[model samples]
Target: MKKISSNRKKNHLAWTIALVMAAPFACASDVNFSGFLSVGGGMLDDEDAVAYGGYDEEDLTFDRNLLGLQVSGQINEKVTATAQLIARSNNDYEVDAEWAYLSWQANDFVKVRAGRLRTPFYMYSDFLDVGYSYAWITPPQEVYYLPFNNVDGVDVYLTGTLGIFDTSLQAYFGSFTDDLVLSGAPADAETRNQIGLSGTLGKDWWTLRAAYHQADLTIDVTGIPISQTATLGSFVNTLRTFGFNSNADRVLVEEDDVTFAEVGINIDTGRFVAAAEHVEFDPGDAILSKNIREYVMVGVRAGDWLIHLTAAKAKDEATHPETGIPVGQPLPVVGSTNFLIGTLQAIANSQAIERDVLTLGTRWDVTTGTAIKFQIDDIDSPDSVLVDGTVVSGQQKVFSVAVQTVF
Candidate 1:
């Protein structure tokens, strides 16, 4: 079934690419074409460590590489249509539709966009895949690793000058459904009643941004349901019999409200660049715990090269609730349900993380619209799992190199 879906995606992408290639001849001067590409690879020092996004100890898989094409056409004096198709190495070479929208220029200060749009959650969320536009080989994964990326809906944007400061505001309403990795397994997920607002204020050499978004999130946990295993099932049944309904529900995932908030600042003064951002995720009353992530980066430019340092961290905001089951206690029928309880508790605690990473990198512009970058990361994850779910204590080192280009 997965293979079939992949084939369909490929066929659709082929047709889209053909149309885009022929658009210039068909529409004469009304259509424009552009694209971006990134070829990258990385490796970890520890061979036992689960690969980071497909990179292994000594293998360079280019799984992080991607190519994207964007086509836009002017339909009339007040409206335009834009679409972007991207093919990623991680998706088995299947091209996916990243953006397809119709934009309307309502006035000089206001505009509207309707269709599939990028979710405005962070400072760099909109242009995440365009590596040539950013200093890092990739954005901080601790903050950018959210499962949901886009929404299908409409948004209104307002931009103008406020005194000496240039200001912009955007409001959007949308919904999204996608497949996500949950607890090391694939699961179907959906976000309903998704709404968001973001604003930016800038003057001279610095800019400040803030955004808020919320939605009702639901995920199908049938693959690893809480009551499917014999031990877990018996434990949950015992808890319910003992009037621990809240505890049981806390261990199960269901429909709940998820909220995200972010604030960031960016500075650029010709030769110096600095950026810092903080974000929070609140999964209210869900099995998932609340988390906070933040990062600070500073860099200096000399000729065609820019060198930067970054520090980032992710921490859990709440500890797992006590299940109130006594350890080493004997219970009727289920002798030692205590062990099962402890295992469940440990799983919950594993979801909480206290991790930090330090990185140093250099990006050299090789040409007008191309760059080559080299980076080294020192990661310290004492109580957290890596992106691939490999548990690592203390510190580990990873190195990466990439070339990015845009045309």
Candidate 2:
């Protein structure tokens, strides 16, 4: 696919009109361009500060604004190309090509694509683009926690009917790079190279999938604060450093390797849909957990309103393949098992992952291209918890409202 290199805002009014007029005589193939822009503002219902690592949540900041453009064309009966570009608040005015792949149809039952492509590791990977999909916003964060967005590689897809069954299989091998290690310690210059496979089976309203991923990790050290006068001061300095510094400072990743596996299913009737997934990760000598992550969600649509409920949980522990050491050791610190100590333990146990969350939200389609969303989230942490800029012993709650639209 040709990369969408232009960032200029363009008008396609004349082209659209001509295409519509020529539709009758056009072949089965065509070129289509579509995109969406979503701008929204939201706030945390409570004004109090909630601290996670060392810093309090930025007080009710502007919700992220996102834009995406997609262009696709069928070159002939057996060839096609697709390209997508996305812009987000985190990158300010910068826009990047998110997906650009060339596909070849080998037969009625098989097709192949290679290039920079979306990794089909999760349920929504294929249709994450904003232009032609419906959703008040993005999927929940807990269910879609992949660190790297895309991989440079190849995909083989098989889709056809076998007897009474419809089947799909996708297998791919690819490598990815990101500043933060995908499943291990946060090395300053972290890298991961991965290979993965996913398959699906479905007929009518039911579908199922299983995916597996394995990667080699590499870490490098570039720049970071060496020391601080006090513990709190040191922690605060680290947070501020990461927040303010661009990619100038560097750190080396001492140990490297990660493995992940996931399986999921989806069922949809006219009025309701249900989905669930289970994922697991092994830290492989980095500062993260070797644990299992899982979640389930259900949604119902009635007229112009849609309601969704989600529950998720994660369990952290020592890498099971390792031999006879105690499962894991508690982080050392003064004053019982405190928040700071717990967070460190959670980090060091390179495997201490225990968290559960429940979220309830409703989306109202106010118009063709706009929607309003309100959600209530309840969080549970039996281990010491980080509270409003302070350490607390247990559960937490948060509420948010978002107005999302496309133009």
Worst 10 residues of 1 by lDDT: 1-10
Give all TM-scores, in the order shown.
0.87, 0.72
Best-performing candidate as measured by TM-score: 1
Return the TM-score for candidate 2, rounded to 2 decimals: 0.72
Model 2 ranges off by over 4 Å: 1-29, 46-60, 129-136, 181-193, 221-255, 318-347, 368-370, 382-395, 403-407
- Model 1 residue pairs with clashes: none
Q: Give me candidate 1's TM-score against the actual structure.
A: 0.87
Candidate 1 per-residue lDDT over residues 205-262, each given as its tens digit: 9999999999988866445434335433455566677556876666655667889999
Q: How does residue 121 of candidate 1 score in lDDT?
A: 92
Q: For every model in order, what is the number of clashing pairs?
A: 0, 13
- Segments in model 1 whose C-alpha atoms lie over 4 Å from true places: 1-29, 49-54, 225-243, 318-341, 383-394
Predicted structure with the largest lDDT when compared to the true one: 1
Model 2 is weakest, by summed lDDT over 10 consecutive residues, at 244-253
Name the lDDT value of residue 346 in candidate 1: 67
